[model samples]
Target chain A: MATLSLRDVRKSFAATQVLHGIELEVADGELVVIVGASGCGKSTLLRIVAGLETATSGQVVINNRDVTELEPADRDIAMVFQNYALYPHMSVFGNMAYGLKIRGMDKAEIERRVKAAAEILGIGPLLERKPKQLSGGQRQRVAMGRAIVREPALFLFDEPLSNLDAKLRVQMRAEIRRLQRRLGVTSLFVTHDQVEAMTLGDRLVVMNAGRAAQVAPPMEIFERPADTYVAGFIGSPAMNFIPAVLEDGGASAKLEDGSSIRFADGPRPGPAGRRLTLGLRPEHVEPTNGDGSIPLTVELIEPLGSETVVHGRAAGGMPIVTRLQGAFSGQSLSVHLSPKHLHVFDAETGRRLDS
Target chain B: MSSTALPAAVPMQAERDDALLRATRRRRVMSKIVAHGALILGVLIVAFPIWMTLVGSTHDAATIGRGDVPLLPGSHAIENYATAWNEGGGKSRTTPAALMLWNSLLMALLIAVGKITISILSAYAVVFFRFPLRMAAFWAIFITLMLPVEVRIIPTFQVIVDLSLGNTWAGLIIPLIASATATLLFRQFFLTIPDEFVEAAKIDGAGPLRFLKDVVLPLSLTNIAAMFVILFIYGWNQYLWPLLIINDRSMETIVVGLSKMIGSGDSQNEWNTIMATAVLALLPPVLVVALMQRWFVRGLTETEK
Candidate 1:
């Protein structure tokens, strides 16, 4: 187990900069997941930590040692690639024992480690089978067994479960979590899947455009996102942003359609008449029959088994989606945006504003 | 009403399906007959000359010299083969068939192995490394594919003479071992190996040579086997170059020595012994192909990667 510190990490390719000074600290035995959309440089960050790619400028410290100049092998880290990258010609046991053999480990020790890892992965009977003969899930287990046998200081996973089917992906995701916990290895997992990040990581680093937009526990990121990007990205059906302006000494927000909603938490620390963007999650919007409810012209309805997601537009052509508890067959309905769960952000900067 | 109608339609549908199945089976049997006929005719056409040589090798020298080549084996088979194996066939009778056969086998093996090793290494360097003038090096090798041995025969001979390699095995093999075609084939095969394998090898602490031995070499076994068969046949059939290089009768390959065994309008020539030597020269290449036929087909059709 080891702590990883990426200090002022910046990367640039030719003239276009990709990563713009990312700083993160991963504690020992913590599985920190770097989650983002494609082209957000989440994989690039993981590769940098793996020493597969050198940062344009920064320091990568693993267990208080500078590893920026070290080769991937010398850095004592193992990576599970997206495609599994198992040696097609070698048997499962050979694949797992290759690294230790290269290090001049004794034959008996290599066998013992490979056998133990195979037992952990429940692939003991498949030790002599080639990669092509194994199913996709079995190959994934072999890939993890290869990493586990190394017992490296850190584990780097580059979308390891992305190639599996949906069911297998979920199953392997849970298995990876359990295995990592048992091994207590410091790992940096990179993926474009927010659900994988939420379910797998001890802490999530929500990356946006090569920068860590928010770094916190999954629920913290879901409950109180650092910015509009993280707020919209983390939750399902995404948080909706309604253009509004502060009113009554920042005690309430007046939306564009001349509707005002008072803040239940308290008055935010902003000047009156300041432009503000009110954030409301889909699940937070309640279908109400009371006063002060905004009418949403229902455009589409998706009837999921447990809940229904209603897509509609509010006044002034602002699109809003609300998740209702049960099926509702209606042309239009009124939704009350609860002040208790409203996310306040500055219209100019997308940064969350505190009340 | 629908159930009553279905009973009447079922018999008619079954009759039509049965007729269709019979027609398909008839066509399949007719096509099989035609295919086997064509294959047998083609095999006979190709094997006729070899059959003639085999039959002629079993006859007495007088039978072949008189232009009465036997269609069936004669009682002189054992004697003719013994004479060919022990005594040389030409008028000088200096180089024995045993020595010539050994020379040819060694040369073919050397050339095949040398070509494969050099081509695989060069192709690996060209495909994997980021050296200066890398593409220039590859193109230069590719350009040599257009230049056959006949095209540069004079200069190549001069180089062999100046290096004092004439009459030596090096003169016969070295000039022919640098194969551009084999290099290109290997380069194409290496390109299909995914980048992830290299990365995984790197993470496993394997350097370039280790990776080549552990991963690249094993994956390339089929291709190597295929190339070996082709190069062995090409080496075994080398006539012009071996003729020009070897002045010593002891250094003569089977192909070169077999041609020398024939005399122009000489009634006293040992035609039976010459035919036996000819049959011996064809054996090694056929054996190589037969042994590696499975790998040869798989190498061309399927990629392990």
Candidate 2:
């Protein structure tokens, strides 16, 4: 019954509408991640779901019951914020038990639950410490512990790992995913980092500006982007876009410097003769001394040890990045783009074209 | 800026570099010294009057007037203090000055608590919630910051009179309950409170009042304590309003009553006792402020951050 659904959710601050109509659902024990850049209204959407903000015109149902107008306190949910937002004056124990104490929980019960949560978060030794005394990671753990003690129906995380350093963020991200899985709680995590959303979410929701670009499993989102924006945003190095024209029953991409690239797969009707946007993931394209390969002169080679990222441009100034395997160090390497991984988009609307 | 711009700008303006560098450096150093000197001078100007009150408290009236009286402690401080306390009030019945002291303390406490309660809650309402006329009410209250309390004194006085609080503690406390400055200060500090914190509390399922008490109140200790100190000092040191309102010497606050004693020194006022009572009059605020200074500056600075 703790499953939630948002129907036609919208928000506007005066003249500016920050969130368009957003429809989403979360079944019991599901983990959903909403990913978008800053000011894209991803955080606002999460805030609305958490009952911290009211949607301008929408129905938010929790457990199939309309909880749209309910006070946040009565909504039966818990949230962890990006900044942790720990009560500075309170010790860790006090912070964890504050909500229960307000709900008239028995003193011993509050203590026991707080202690248990502290143990779960590995903050038992630091319960007496204030937030100021703890490190960033510890503070994050305390924030989680405070949420855990509430034992609410759903958990809301608003970029909770964003404040941590890279190493800590990675480690905490895994820990949070593991914890969420173990607790089997319905959770909605909001983050601008697509990598985080892809890895941590049971279902990844890619948001662009204010709308959901695509919603799918990680592999599906990465492999089959719903649109040009989703293709560009979901991947780390981003999909390269090359302007193309369909000719002789095939697609041909024209580079700015007048060089042309031909894909082995023939072009379809709607996208032929018109300007076509060609998409290639960095990993799918490669350096080759073979035929049907796009020639590229490497301008820079970023050797990331495991996978080298080759940055180069075609004769037409269409910049491209090729993800290569091990030790390819040079500034003039040529890449062979695989037609199998190529994505076609209609140039007019940036929508992905089906093969 | 790009690295090329520096060399381009530097060489093309060769004539501008003539005395510009030296003059600017010299001006920087001169202004630095003057700034520090002014700061020290300003502190001295503020502290000297309080210091004088303390020194005057330790001596008889004639010694105080000697002008060359040493800054060090005098021998008769204890006796002078006792005399100031004993004769500072009235002719026997309940030693009305004690009653005055009690009355002033009660009024100040009531006013301080009332002003703080109304102001902090109002600020919270404006900051973290949304309703019709929210911004309108905020702007209306904010416009008061531009209008000095001095400008509204006549109307405020009339309002106090109409409420039948004339010459009473209620008269003193009521007009001071909703201070524009306190609300403004509280609003500033409250704005620094992150909305994320409120959301976190909300998702924890906390009601508005509970959120305020359990979350907002705890986070706001330093600010509230600092604001409390400031408002208390204002209430304690109030003079002109009390003088105009309270004709009863027995009900007069220390400032008003002290003014009366100084002005009506018809029997060669006991300078020793006057100085001592003056010292007593200043102690509470001075001690409270000194103790709370750390929190005050911290709160003020955080308001901007």
Candidate 3:
């Protein structure tokens, strides 16, 4: 395994630009997860690294050698697709052994690698079964096994668990992580699921509209989103946005009822009365006892085992979410912010004002 | 009593309920009668010509002229077969019916195999790889499906003649080797195959050829079966091109050779022998269709998505 680097990589399909000057590096045996909403160019960046797509005007250097024009086969990278594109005609064994056989590995060695990979996937009994006979989860495993047998320099996963059921997705997600850790190859994974990025990625690269918003570890991403887009795209129940204005001694958001809620932080960069946006995560919201707080009227309640998510509208017509610990039995509710948990962004530019 | 409560058994209730039930029954029975009538009409429309062909294939020239052949199989079937088989060729001026059948079948196999193999390779390249002029080449191949062979026949024929492949199987195989229908079908189907699977194979270090053969082609057995049936049927029934090129009677396909039997001879046109030869010639393609019938429909519909 060796380091891979992209220097000002850009890609465009005809006139439509998909990736814009992406600069990233993957050290030996590092696993980087690229996360974003749909059309964010995360998948395109991974495809660029795998040599499935060519950079429009940049260099893709692997181990200090420029391989910008190399085909996927020559790149020595393995990729697992979301749909698990297994050969429908081949049995599990054939599918797993295909890559090795192509690279001119001995037949006995091919069998050994296939059997070993199949065992790792716990699909030993599935060796003789064709792809159609296998379930979605099994086919995904076969796809992984096909990649595993080659032991390529890098492993690329393009949302490989999206087709699976919830339970199976979690299971396979863990299996993939474990397998990658065991193999320790330089890897790049693309996903739209922030949760997957948090749990599976060694470091997360949050992208939006063909640009990287932030590249940080999972906790750091949640703790310090580099911009408004990263803050909104990298969390669950997405952070609530309420229009606000900077005022004397604090940030002030005027409520629909003509009242105001004030949050104190370090000195503002922009001047007072400048319009800004306030962001609050659901988990930081607490049921308050007064009308002076961010007044909210409950609209919907979703109970998911450990917590109940209360959907409501904050004052000034902004949508709000408050997560109630365990199952809370109440319809009429109010929320108060913890003050320090608020995120402030420039209303026009949508840039985060705090680190 | 409430609005929904029924009255006790009385003359009024009994007769009124029975009449209401009778009306519903009559409507159901009328619908059944109409459905059966429509079914019979459809069956008769389709089965009439087939029944006529079967009866005519059995009767000799005398019964056919008299138009008095029964629904039962005739005893003259053996003699009719012998005549079609021999073609009364004391001098080899024309090939017999069996030779024509062989020629047609061989052409179908070459066409089917060649078209399918090329379709898989070209479709794989276009769908999964990034190369120069990738999509332009795809659309170029795809455009040929819309432009009928009639538009290109003259140039095609000239090319065949120039290549000295006239009246040969190579003539039949060369021009139509890249079937747009198969290529388009496989391309659409391959597109539906998850990109992840291709990624998986690539990570496995499988090259393009290995990917096509081991990863793609196997998943395509249904497509192959379907393509075989459709292309084989097309090649088997093709008449105009072979008829135009093959002046030698021995080189004609079953369709062309069968048509020749009708107008060329003074043997009173041997209606029975001609019909018998037609039926025999139609059997292999029919059998092939029968064998792959289920896959034909599924493959067409499945790949379309």
Candidate 4:
């Protein structure tokens, strides 16, 4: 059984702390994705797990073995680098077999493993060719094949699909998810792409400024981000945040322009007249044909074939985007935000206040 | 009426264009001739000494001693070559030209391979590993770039004597093996390798030596071949070092042997044999460079990239 755990993993470079007390655990066969913006220490955390980088303070345990002080080779882990670091001179089979050969595995066993990985990656025909001869997508597959041939205890992927074009990235991520499930190897993947994190991760670690802001399943992070950072970061076109003050015994928050939205699920853990931020995703804001909705001054409309995204300024001068079906064209339009879709965070600390 | 006017303007414009084209063609032809002339002149200027030596080697020793070196080859070609190959030409010496060539070849190959091996390892260590005083160690090696063998001849000779490597092939090859230029070049080439390769190798369970053999060395093939060419020529052309170290006649390299054949000024030197030995001395380096020229150019350009 393969499981990975990090206990208070911290990393510092010179005087700057790149990762601060990162605690995570991956169950057997689980794929945990650490997603963040660049320089948020997601890659550093993955590297620490891979044993390529050492944590300043903490323990990295793999399969109940403490591997914090071990070299990467002794950790029994495989990694797919962001650049798909295939040996340029070696053929695909050779690149896949190199790790096995280094461990002095039998020649037949090495060949068997390499062939199996090549077949799994659908690169059997291309195994005789050098990495330079392969296309970018093929090279990416070979990198995965190389990692797969090792059959290590854990798989660490450091933004492996970021180098591919967007269309290919989607296809590759699906393949990666399928492979991980089939192999039942615990893995930790890091990327700056939220879509990748959402679709591929069994659980997502939403990282912000060297700390995990929220750790939950994809829909949970989307529906209820732990803080304003995760609320603004996870969704496309981002979640709209507006200054608001909690009122009516924390059941409702009044926008700066006097419009009010109540928590649909339940009351938040805050007193009345408390200042907080209200967040609503672009997709959740529905356009209505009545005076009951807040007025949005239409500034621009982005037509994305099926749905149009309307960019406008809300009544409180806060710019917001709303996704609408078909097309809507007007200088001013009214959109309604449901109380169930509202997210409230402390104004001073940006921490979520509502359950 | 507009068509008629257009025809008149078109012919005049065509005539002007034709004149301009003709002028450009004429200038191009003239420039080509000038370029050819300049190139031929440069070739002749560069090739004159080699040509003179080639012609001089074919003449008889007596004829060369008479101070009548010919521009054209003489009838004594085979005789001079055979004499030079079988017997040393100086009055006091009798070592064969073949033995000198053999010594030179062994020394050059040893020095070349030795320098490359040392350089590649040192460069790998310097670039890939992070130890204490890494930059300091690198700078120490780099500073040796300015100090050639000529500058440190006395101390090197003394060290050779102390080590008791005097008059041995080891003395000849070892003193000139460590090359700061090769190390620096290899280090620079190694630096261009992406860090991902090392990281990937580590994750692949390849140790330092395995990584060097499986990844680093294979990637450095072109660089190694190119360095081999350069170091071979550099080793083959070593004159002063061999002369200082090799006291035994049998260990004397062709370059040193050739210099010995030409006695001090005013003596009746074996000019023909000396010229023949010179030709032999130049052959291997030229052949080495010619054979590896493709890899040399590609390696240099790829190393930079």
lDDT leader? 1
Q: Which 10 successive residues of model 4 chain B have the least lDDT summed? A: B296-305
Which candidate, 3 or 4, would have the higher DockQ against the true structure? 4
Query: What is each candidate's DockQ, to 2 decimals?
Result: 0.65, 0.35, 0.41, 0.60
1 against 2, candidate with superior lDDT:
1
- What C-alpha lDDT, on a 0 to 100 scale, does residue B107 get in candidate 3? 76
- lDDT by residue (A84-125, candidate 1, tens digit) is 899988999999999999999999999999999999999999
Per-model C-alpha lDDT, please? Answer: 0.92, 0.80, 0.80, 0.88
lDDT of 3 by residue, A201-264 (tens): 8899999899888888899989777778988887788887777787665456554455666666
lDDT of 2: 0.80
C-alpha lDDT of residue B172 in model 2: 78
- Check candidate 4 and list the clashing pairs: none
Q: What share of the true interface contacts does each candidate keep?
A: 0.68, 0.66, 0.70, 0.75
Query: What is chain B's TM-score across the candidates, in the order shown?
Result: 0.88, 0.74, 0.86, 0.91
For candidate 3 chain A, which ten residues in a row score worst on lDDT? A249-258
Kindly list the per-residue Cα lDDT of model 3 for residues B1-305, writing each as its tens digit: 55445554466788998999999999999999999999999999998877777777788777876757567667788788777776722223246778888888887788888888889888988998889999999999999989888788899999999999987777877776779999999998789776656766665566677667665676677778978888888888877888877777767788987777765444555677777788888799989988898766676564421
At residue B242, what lDDT does model 1 achieve? Answer: 94
**Highest TM-score among the candidates is held by which one?**
4
Report how far residue B109 has shifted in candidate 3, in Å. Answer: 4.0
